[model samples]
Target chain A: MKMAILVIAMLVFANQTLFEQLKEKCELSKNEYLIVIFQTPGNCVKCFIEPMDLVELIKKNSLGINYKLMALVSVEREIELKVFQKENDWKHYMLVDDGNARKDLGAKGIAMMIILDSRGKIMAEFLPNQYDKNIEKAKKFVKSR
Target chain B: MKIILITFVTLTLISSNCTMKTQHILEYKPEKLQTQNLNKINIEPKGIIEIEEDENNIIQQITSVAIIGESNTLALINGKDLLFYDNTTGKFIKKIEATFEMTDLVAKSGRKPYIDSNYERRKVEVPYISTTNYTQNGIDGEIAQQFIKNFFMSLKNINNTFYSFGTIYCYYIGSSEKSIDNIPVLFVLNDELNIESYVVMDLNKNSHAIAYDFYINNYIYLSAPGMYKVPAFGGEFDSYPTAAKYDLEGNFIKSVSHMTNNYLLKGGLKNGWVYPRFIEVNNHIMIVYPEELAVFGENKKLFDLQNLPFKNDSGFVYYQDYLRYCRSKEMRPDIDVIARLFPIKIIDAFENENKFYPIILVWDKNKPMGFYYLIQEYTSDGKLLREVALDDEPENQIRQFAFNKYDKELVLFKKSKTSWTAEKWSLR
Candidate 1:
């Protein structure tokens, strides 16, 4: 009985790269950069506003055709995820994430942003405070070879 | 049993500590508008304007829409192409193409794609495409004459001989490797159909795009949601909502100020964070949300946040309790069923006679199976007027509304099965 319980726990908390998980969930395109925003209900206040700013940034810069901005929501059920997505008008730009994604990415901060290369390699990570800087750096990194 | 009991106690204590208890912001839940008031309302079926979607797909997208008040003229813009219609008759007046080309917005950085990929950084172009190559010849441009001629022809019998055309400003964004630029320009035509102001206003200094701009009392108030100050990322903490008043000729006036907390959560039966909607009511500026009601003084100082009572005790259930209930569902089995049916959002608001009618869009897991929208009206002093079932079809909900204060009527526009339709309802 003890061995079976241990096996179940290990399966539940199996280690996996956040990049791989996001790539699978968001259907990330090849040879294009990816910007993922890690969010949870605990940081719902800031979480609600950052997506709007990011959408504006993407639209103003005409970066939609160049890069993919995906939001990975953590620990939210189906109903909560739907509410968050519909409220934010993020139907096209978000994927529901399990609790493990945050743990895998080491993104414990509120509304942390992670930038990945075309092949799903972690390029840079940014906390909520460094939002504008994160956008600037991501744009530069995405555009650079 | 002892271990489970100890764990439950510890969890409850920890959860209590997690709750952030702020002063409870009040929300109003009014009873239905009295039948006397309801019977007083008169709805007149004026006319229906059918907006057709582009079949050929040549038009990039409909960027903006404007309705010329009283004149009954509607202008729909798709890229540089402008389509005009006589609202009363639903007649297509004319289509004018404006040329917009800003090639100076090319990204300079030699940013390439992945290794071995031959991707080059392309120049960012504004006014991406132009169909016509018409030029401005003189004082009254050639294209402007055609517009005025058609407009005058359509409104032949109007008594007011002298008509002042409305100036509709269009914004175009420009970007390069280093910075982003927003260019706002106003296009107006003279009586003879000439361009009065080729480019009335060009503002590129602000980092964030203007959230909203409207004309009221002879002054155009442009509001920026807030500054892009570092560390805040335009959140409620640092989002400074400031308005710049501009004259008709695009001259700058004084800056308007308002003391507001953008993150105020509307506490009621259906609780959520509410953003402020600013309006000019009876020569005074008022900021209102479904839950919050406040009038600004001459100095733009907001009134104290009022605490209003809820209709039922269920409405008094604070957000901290709600959050705790949602989080610790395993410990508390009774609330599990209730918490699962989470409300979606307050989708729309309509104001009439100092009363705000909020339309809440909620989704219930069992009965409805999909989104259910409800419209509830509340008085200025936090009294519930009436609640009505507005819409159930998620796709068909009121998106844009035009209020006719003179007629004491509210006009609602929504997407019908095939096209869009407008329905007008009397307010008085």
Candidate 2:
């Protein structure tokens, strides 16, 4: 089930029209790397406030300018997501998924970030507990390429 | 020199004396929510049992576990699958072939699993899956969908039989205009993991659903929170924090009125739903409030820890902080706001020798290490028996745990890179 979702997500993004839509939605594009973040509810107190924390990190250039960002937020409650988005003022485009995107991407109940290349190939996947570890290597790889 | 000589003489006399009263002066129970009288019980870590997993059974995580004394097999739930292991040694036996699909009904993400209406007939193919919602049902509210015989929601053990507490949303499935009726039932399972018998515990409040269930010696106590306005249907909010009592066979015995919340129109403010972490201790219902522990005796008024000399100041506290905390995980744990400033939850309980103990994961804000977590054991009489420190590695060293009464061993499910392992620690 997870592989099928991944293949379908990859195929959708891999397509030219959908890729163009993605670029237009975020109003940004590049040939380097795209960072897709999967947000889930009910893990820790950290998970609930993650969007604002993440935005703070990006504003301080903590993530470095190696990739464009997209958020695949689990739409457990649409109103709650809207409140988070409004309060955090996240500039990146967020795709509201009522589907099992978090479960399929293996985020389960934690926040996950996957760095994908232009061809929809996963370059680096940073999981929960420690989302900062090995993130610099991915940023370096993206910048070097 | 004089004091030393007196001590020497006392020690000599004490050593010479044989008759001594070693039991029951009735240790004092605390009167307030002030942190006090907690003793640290030390236990050495036993060796880790690497639960071998293969291509077939890839255990990503575990949520709940039980030690089936009669069968001599330990049971665990990961997602929807129930895995069994040897009780003595934590060895993977087999993942039962009991995954049922709930097709006809739409996959409602957060609805209670009332679909277990087909449970009595053993119709394995009907009721669905999903363990997303956490209610007053407490920590054991995991693996709540359809497994073997629709066995889920509050998997508790009384002696040898496995009892599961669940809500049966019984309306006219035979076609009713009004919404479904709320009927909470307790299903007892046999040694072979079959639903032997069940009792329909009617709390008489059909409009309100039960939050948590605690089956003490003679009766079952449940926290039934009042109703809140639903967004989908746009309904009325009529909820009260009620501690109800029932018999083992699901009969409504009585109820104890609790101090209402000062927050919103209803319910205590906390993460993972209402009915603050509660337990039955000393024949009194111990309700974990924000800044207080409300205890109620049978057919008595709600009071604090010390008998009837207790007071409840719950009406002034607003529940919006908790509701906000549930939605936005911002941490501003003010004293009278979120008592459970951290993740306060009852992990699981165990019976050792002849006493009942509930294990709770609590946090100490002033703990030196920034975020100090320890597993606290509370005696049946509502005393903080002892606590053991959990390894603070940050990424989640211990996710879930189950205690085996006979062996007096605690099985901790720790996740490695890809596989899962069990660490056995004897807390005797």
Q: Which candidate number maximizes lDDT?
A: 2
- CAPRI classification of candidate 2: incorrect
User: Candidate 1: misplaced stretches above 4 Å?
Assistant: A1-145, B1-49, B56-66, B76-83, B89-177, B186-211, B226-239, B249-251, B262-292, B295-395, B404-409, B426-428
Instruction: For each candidate, give its TM-score against the true structure.
Output: 0.43, 0.50
lDDT of 1 at B157: 9
Q: Indicate the DockQ of the complex predicted as candidate 2.
A: 0.04
List model 1 lDDT by residue over B133-249, tens digit each.
223212223332222211111001012121112222222223322222233334454333234443233232221214233333465444433232222322324323344455765
- Candidate 2 lDDT: 0.48
After superposition, candidate 2 runs with Cα above 4 Å error: A1-145, B1-39, B52-61, B94-151, B166-185, B200-203, B210-212, B216-218, B228-239, B256-273, B276-360, B364-369, B375-388
Interface RMSD of 2: 13.8
